[model samples]
Target: MDGTLIVGVDGSGAALRALDWAADEAVRGGFPLRIVHASGWEWYEGHEPSFGINRDVVRAQA
Candidate 1:
């Protein structure tokens, strides 16, 4: 298939587990894996956003 296998992770164990399963499925089907992670903690909790994340790497690859 030309479609990708997408998984969303939010720094949770459950999400990570889902990612692992999705990865396996993607490999078995010869599809690409896309990890999607989003956070709004900075806006709600006044916390600073995370830096040095892999956003640049993902964007470059995309």
Candidate 2:
């Protein structure tokens, strides 16, 4: 089974803080971190989030 940490971000300082923490946790654990930004509904006529680029398993620190 695979583990993951999902964080929601919106280009704010607080969101960045959460992202930083999430990144650290992912580095501590052998799990993947998924950062998702609700790409705004205005441009949602037909848009799909990038699946392969930003999605990868991160190795824990040794």
Per-residue accuracy of model 1 over 1-62 as CA lDDT, tens digit each: 67999999876889889989999999999999999985545533653345645668645543
Mark the regions of model 1 whose C-alpha exceeds 4 Å error after superposition.
42-62
List model 2 lDDT by residue over 1-62, tens digit each.
Answer: 35898998876889899999999988888679999874445544554565532334311210
Worst 10 residues of 1 by lDDT: 40-49
| Deviating ranges (above 4 Å) for candidate 2 | 39-62
C-alpha-based local distance difference test score of model 2 = 0.70
lDDT winner: 1
Relative to the true structure, candidate 2 reaches a TM of 0.57
Candidate 2's error at 54, in angstroms? 22
Give per-model CA RMSD: 6.6, 9.8
